[model samples]
Target chain A: EIVEALIRGAGPSSLEGVRVLLTAGPTREPVDPVRFLGNRSSGRMGYALAESLADLGARVVLVSGPTALSMPRVHERIGVETALEMHAAVMSRVADCDLFVATAAVADYRPERPADGKIKKSAEGLTLRLVRNPDILSEVAALDPAPFTVGFAAETERVADYALGKLRDKRLDMIAANLVGGERGGFERDENALSVFWPEGSRDLPMMSKTRLAAELAALIAERYRERHAAST
Target chain B: EIVEALIRGAGPSSLEGVRVLLTAGPTREPVDPVRFLGNRSSGRMGYALAESLADLGARVVLVSGPTALSMPRVHERIGVETALEMHAAVMSRVADCDLFVATAAVADYRPERPADGKIKKSAEGLTLRLVRNPDILSEVAALDPAPFTVGFAAETERVADYALGKLRDKRLDMIAANLVGGERGGFERDENALSVFWPEGSRDLPMMSKTRLAAELAALIAERYRERHAAST
Candidate 1:
């Protein structure tokens, strides 16, 4: 049992000396000084991945948004805010990486113009112009030196079909799909369930701790990374 | 614009009075007075669903596990701790529901004998005896008055194969699949990616807030529920 676990833990030799880049948490799109658009992301999942990657002896760069969580050990932690900042930080370091994972809940759209002062609500309803934010994963995957890019798909329906489309449309090497229905495990909760899809095969890890799932995903990513690397070579 | 939004929301008249029962958050299995095996599940998804179901005027019963978040408006909330407690609660109420969604991260195994007293540290490593916990979704689906059941498959790889298998094997009407990996969002994060699959058609909701996804899912569930109901009649 110990030996089997060890084998599973170590993964393949190709995983050695690889570099991993991950983005985590939620991006805050400012509407006003007092109010901003943000999700319930706590950054726990990203922290778990950073720890898991480090445990596997991979050099990891964890680019995080504003999160209350502490930084994981044995990795380079870059903190930023807004989707633009995250995209810049990731782009600066992505060239030197071997694997790229985008886990941040980046705002798909942002206020077109920032309110110079906090807007006091009128008796009438208010309206604010919005513009699309940067597509970080799609941008990275489109790069010439694109590392094995992985994207995340959070859907409520037709998760697999959409994931496959993203995998093809975004040109991602793989995608991790999840259902967002229950409040606890999907966001700001400590546990999660994941369905990972790749070009060849996919597997289910069931519902487990973000910590345990992160480690399991790291092992599988290493394995798949090696397989893809070998086939390309 | 409000009227237009309402019209967009009320796509046809097929989903008027659906009733839904959902489970969310993590279940704790106690081993001692102060110690228990539990994951970090926040219950955001289920609360979001409850909120959406209410918005669509569906009578909703949300059987939840322990969490810090407040209950979503317009739904009945029943909180539980142990798996057995959750099982009993779900079984008691599941029969009348028109749709059932299971998103709770229930523990797969529990300590065989929960120690009454905290074990003192010794030189030898501690060993624990574990027993399998009941599959809540499967059990509910097997019931005579089983509602339109939806289960979640969180996998690391082989997502579709495993998810579709579960949809058939567990006899679920549909399964929401998620892949857990580096940070973007899964398990305690703010956003999630989902792939919802059934025997025929499937769709995907891209990474978004669990709240928004829940609204979309509730809509889909309501539509599917009506279709299934009509087919049976």
Candidate 2:
């Protein structure tokens, strides 16, 4: 109990008694029985964020994709493989959450017709038709009494501009943007820096370990969430 | 030194002083900076095989794809991400080796033109044009003084037929076939069963832990390798 209290005091515990829905990792889109379309996300950042939110006394329900990471000590965890499965998992439970954070790098498109068997290398060339997947974040934000929605943007270029556009277009309460495909911290790395944006202002969190960064981001999120509630009441 | 002798005595050390070129894990074909076409190989079997071969006193050069597995104790490990890279690494080293084992589930096709930047999710649908990758196993066996080549066939159905066809078609000395996409013993599983075939005969290795299976398979490989050399002499 003392240890828990100390941890709570270290960061803003304004999220006490709040329920959070968090999604992490990259979703795989099947091409065949063995092959799929995947990404480089290691799920370290989002898993650390889940722990940080739980430390601030929030009840965290984590929806995860296929990752090598062990489950975090959150209230619950729902494992899904594809974007469709993740969307279903989140939509089924988002009604009870006080906040929603989408950190999953869900596939934008999936093979339109996945082969039932393994494809043989008989052809000289092949063409795969892909169809767009549903936007999970936009759907959650469109809820009648939506929770304080937060989105994450991983861009190779124009990080801030893309993040701001997402924040405005998705009607999210906040957005965290980061540059990927660089030598520095990003996917598959333990450390990262994020540009956080809200309706009124924005802040830059410097490069640091994902664990430390998560705690700081959690504190900022708590402050903004409290202020939004205060304004509404 | 004592431990090494004990390990060698436990299994056939017939491979002592032999040079081996082996490939393991699934190669990733990049769709873009962030997304890739990947398979379900976990690299456990191949890594275990590398250790088992090393235990028998062979100098193992492992050309591997991206895997979460730690580097196995071997003479050398060449890490690669794509099928083309793996092919280059193997082809450059195969001439110096006496035995070649192709265990990697290399992609049959890669995107014809991979995008320079992360592709935005603007279109409702997209078509990806893929071109066939170089057949690494076939090329290795086609060498004038080709080493004793062993291939792996991962099939969802007709396991034995495919294994034999590949063995004959690729002119390989041996082929190990296993069923994937099943409920038991295949890709991503620590335990597996292999149907090993040679020109004269075939053997069925029952389901067991990959480590033990590797040791058994290595012994069989050593026996066949010696037989082929003696016949040639």
Candidate 3:
């Protein structure tokens, strides 16, 4: 009821003519011809956000990694694999988008040099040399005329502190923090809860289907975006 | 054409009344509440095997990991996550199966103690302590009345030597070896090739859709199985 009211209050045109860019799913960093580093992101939340944002009249450009999700109803969808590919995709189009959402659960590292052939298994085991992946959100935040950036911190522990740290460190305008796993919500689940925070204010969103949560978040983001735009003007 | 003939040569009773246990897809080993160790095994080949085996009159019990593919037409489909879960699921049913196919890309190691809550990200980085998971195929091979086991070696390099070594070391009745990744084959692609190896014989299966490949492989396994049974009798 609370979230529904929030959505109803925003009205359309809150994001009319606004262009939004979103990232979703887990990036695959190849270890060899057959293997790769990946996370357990199902891309549901991100897809929902794309749909909700589009519903609010934003032209959504979705850059997604490997997932089973059908394409969201959006202006465009750019498919990618590794973090490097995603970084390239997002940076090339940042200047055209008004609001940016980073919902992807990107791997932090990739094999420094993926083998041309499969590595043979040894009884003693094998070790991989991994290198850090570029932080996409951080890069976007550093842009000269950056979009209104909202990032996600899907944490299992110490949710608030970490989310806040990312908001400050990455210079994000807002961050949505959530816990994954368990019956109520998490990876691959249909329902979720979020704690949204900005520099000066915060709101706790109760557990709900990713669809409804996205609708509410889209509305809230639109309101904040319009307020910031008006103040700047 | 050769592969099609191979399937045509096998009679309908090739695997009749055979209770086959198969494992497919890639296991998820949790690192934290929101993160896990996973690989990209689409379960395409395994699902194909299940369908083909069922068509040959085997009672197929498929234990699979997380995948985007739909359930194969088989006697039963048991979904699981993590190496531990897969191990347990396969072992519990080993008593009832006459033949076993180990196709799942089970993670060799898993986080020793996955965090109950999401781990906080630090600029410094994060490390996980992983422990070796039980070798499902090895354990099944050691069973008192072991099923005639077939294993898979999905390799990028040294495919033959490694697969043969596993065939002998694990006491497997047969092993299917394949190279992953390229224009015509490997992960996510619809087609593949395999080198089938047994104790004293080998057969090279050329590139084809996983559907056709599964049919040929199923026929070969059934023939080998019947021959072994006849000799024993």
Candidate 4:
């Protein structure tokens, strides 16, 4: 049994029979019928992750926000535009999965009141009141018999510290953190680096193409997931 | 001279030697390093116009906002992110153009004080103060030796009245109005209809592909431009 577990963690079929529910892309919070408050996520990293996990024989269900990317080959894909819709979609499928990854840059807040029609340019200055959106990752992690929940944090400063804080505060199984707003290796780019953290230890993934990075991250996740399963069983 | 002018308006080389400046896509207003306020323009119509005008032998200089579309074949293409950047690019080149078409859906307002870093999700509610961006079309039309200025109006209600209002108020030579926010034929769609209004007359362009619409609009613009030039000199 020990040898089988070791082989499973190192092989391509490491995640075979594991079910994953993942979210990707940036959610657009509507300010009106035409305008929206959005972020700069291109969804490449998350899409790559989905593909990598599926290559390991995992059944992946992708809950995606508005993006120009074509659908990745997964068990299912649910398209969503806003944070609320994505939240609903994810919650509906969370129960059936052994793992959940929240990689989408979901809006932290949305306009308190979105205009039905296009808002006219009548005001010299406009003040928009924004209400906080639900914390999808925290909620999923807190579920009874929760899956191994992993979250992504894109920060401009203190990348590792913030990622660790989120992992602890949200009671998540793991967190992958990256620095954004720099000249390279973040949002809108095809390459990135990650500082991955869990309760026990952390790993630094050097800068590389998102495809290669996803494969590396998937391997780490499979190993950790198998270890936890072995200990629990 | 009359026969020459008539043939010029009807032929493919109608705009031979004409210098055209056009703007396309939707401007993004930064709320922070990560978040932005944006609209739903696909930049298809403006790109189509650039292609059509270039086919008619015009030297097209396109000032474009960030979009997913590839570069259209034109004499020059200036890519911009914010409304202020777009305004600067257009103003710098306006003096050299014979015609200016504003197809971009520039943001009406931008966050007054954008944060240098990503705003944390600590606050339950937040208020964003927004200030109006420069009216690029009006400023260009107000230039001393302004090009034959044309504007596009996307309205949710009273399309004709608002379009006529814009033409008269802005002192524009022509305005093309289209209805948006419906189930079909606006913003992100490839097909659209236009109600084009000038000082003395109006023309209704029924629903068609943006490519066909651009060709028709270019012909009308060429005819009107020739008439205006003949009357002037």
Candidate 5:
């Protein structure tokens, strides 16, 4: 199996000292204690990423939103909810990391004024005031000593075009694309398909199990990281 | 929510009917009763697509492989394993579809001889015969009456270059790219980020819940599908 082969390739002593930072799951924007805006993100993809990175022998720091996924082995796991909390967590320790990945479905907009308690339901139509959340990926990418930064683009049409624009706009080193709309294989599904892209080129990992993809992705990341590092040095 | 705003913008009842075909998850190639080869895919992204399509009032046909996700409510659902199975399933019914998305992660290789029973482990490391699997996306794209085809790429580096390469090699109408690393977001995590690309331009979804991204992707897909359809006609 490729997993077995990959394990062998790493040897017992390989990847012992690598460091990585990752974010996972969905962020909640509270409108009231009983009401909040959120998306249906299970954090599975982020969990799998952490596992794969750990397997590669990287000491990982996982900053997560609320998710059912168990903490991956070999990582410092921190849990948070709101986008602000995530931002704080990420910023606090982003330095000294070799890689940074932002996978959390962070709420782009949050209620400007969160109600202290359950909002009373009235006959009148409710209007909400929202403000934009911080752009986590962009913020990290703009860092002085940014680790290899990667972003993702999940689009329905003009997937390639839009993704490339994001890479340039966000100033990301790379990006991934997810095509939603399938039967049993999208959000909340156990399988997925990914397309990876960079400024110069791109490749498709096709659809596969997330676990396997994570491993392959980790190896590829290691190789690329080394190449970029080598080139810079 | 953006959904409410979009629907309102479309003028309630404007989208009574539409059709879409989406592929999701990762194909598996069996080597024995206990062993099979597959890609790392969580199917979350595709499921998100289905959800967004449904929300937009499209009657969706979702073709998928094995995944842990529940099937999004749709007009039709077909499930299969292996690339060959998925290829047959897609070809059997793709003729009438209005839009086609090749999102499933199909195995590139399969064991030539799948053991009827679990193969006994031998003292010496055994080499299993391998063969190439059919490229389902490319095959469908080559169809005489091809539906609007969209392809995906998951790469570690040079995402744009590689994605563009796939666009040419596979002859796809569009492509999306995702880089896998950091957290579990790429494969199994609920939240994901994306970069949408095509021949013309690109955009970045940034990090967000797959569900939210799915909605945006669907809107874009629907818009582009209409444009492409109109151009062809």
Candidate 6:
């Protein structure tokens, strides 16, 4: 068991020396002094992916948002709270990466103007004006010499359709889709499953601990990345 | 130092036999299958209040939203994630309590109808139709045999005006207001201060660690509760 654990911890060699960038957790968009917009992302999947990549000897840059999980041992870790901060971090590091995985549950919108202080509650109710946040995956894909981009659609309905749609629309080389909140509820859980979709093919990753699933997914990513690199060359 | 720690942890008997209800952390409003509207509240203030109350021999029912903190050893601990859930929990327990502290940073609005599936990113941006969540503080005040309700206002501007306004509008016995995001900031930090207001007068609680502030506030609440009880008798 000890040897098995050690071998599993070390993982594969396909990604040796490769520079990989990944994102995790939920970005917090400040709404006021004490509060900010966020989600229930635990950052488990992305953390697991980072761990697996690092185990495989990849130079990993894990750009993470606010989560309770401790930092993973990787080449670099950039912690951010807001979606805009995450964008800046990813952009600054993209040029040096060989692959990019957009896994953080990034907020699609943020309060257009977060009150400098806490807004007092009113009987009349409140209306918050919000602006769209940058589509991180799309922006990365639009880069002149972009890294192999993998995006995801964690959905509850029509997972395949949405994943494929995002894959095509964002021009992502691959996408992972999953059903959120059920027997395997996505929020704040330790386990997850995924359906990875690529241009001409797809595969089902069965339900398991997030760590195991991420390790397997990371291996798949390494193989696919190499195939793409060879084909392009 | 050890003796001081022990004394602080056990606290005084000022609130002996009291039953107290507190709400802490931030409520989540689901926007889609994989995402929800939320805020950054560490629940430090509320947790501190719970600890102090528990320390003083009061039975505490901590109805909390999402936070990373571990559960305090009190009479009971009720964990919740959304505004509605927190409301339900508080409403169910209010009849048994002599004091109620609405300290949770409940989200004022929630999606009118959250999508069952993940929302696909749109080019023109997406607008979420939101409706106000039920005012838990106001509802508790309206109870036939209401507890001595204490409301909190963590604000950026017009602190006193807003806190007083909420106290009247919600028919609260007392209100505590604080300036959020300054050197102390109000969320996810260890320290805080408040300007507590009653209908007849007000007092300032100086800056201190959340735990210390809570203990001091708890003492004040015990005194105020006794005064009210004596006058009613």
Which DockQ values do the candidates obtain, in the order shown? 0.01, 0.85, 0.41, 0.86, 0.01, 0.49
Q: Write the per-residue lDDT of candidate 2 for residues B131-173, one digit (tens) a residue.
A: 9999999999999899999999999999999999999999999
TM-score of each: 0.49, 0.95, 0.90, 0.96, 0.49, 0.90
Q: What would the per-residue lDDT of candidate 5 be over residues B147-210, giving only the tens digit for each residue?
A: 7788877654566787888888787878877765446367667787777776676777778888
Q: Model 3 chain B, TM?
A: 0.93
lDDT of 1: 0.76
lDDT of 1 by residue, B126-231 (tens): 4445577778999988988788898876655566777888899889998888765346566668898888898888988789988888888877777777677778
- lDDT (C-alpha, whole model) for all candidates: 0.76, 0.93, 0.86, 0.93, 0.73, 0.84
Query: Native contact fraction of candidate 2?
Result: 0.88
With a 3 Å backbone cut-off (N, CA, C), the pairs that clash in candidate 4 are none
Docking class of 6: acceptable
TM-score of chain B of 5: 0.89
Q: Which stretches of candidate 4 lie over 4 Å from their true place?
A: A1-13, B1-13
Q: In model 3 chain B, where is the ten-residue run with the lowest total lDDT?
A: B120-129
Task: Report the C-alpha lDDT of model 4 over B61-148, residue by residue, as the tens digit.
Answer: 9999989999999999999999999999999999999999999999999999999989999989999999999999999999998899
Candidate achieving higher DockQ, 4 or 5:
4
How high a TM-score does candidate 2 get?
A: 0.95
Write the residue-wise lDDT of candidate 2 on A1-233 in tens digits: 99986775644446889999999999999999999999988888999999998988899999999999998989999999999999999999999999999999999999999999999889999999999999999999999999999999999999999999999999999999999989779899989999999999999999999999999998889989988988999
Off by over 4 Å in 1: A1-233, B1-15
Give the better candidate number (4 or 6) by DockQ: 4
**Cα-based lDDT at residue B227, candidate 6:** 77
Evaluated on the second chain alone, the candidates' TM-scores are 0.91, 0.95, 0.93, 0.95, 0.89, 0.92
* Per-prediction backbone clash count: 57, 0, 7, 0, 101, 2
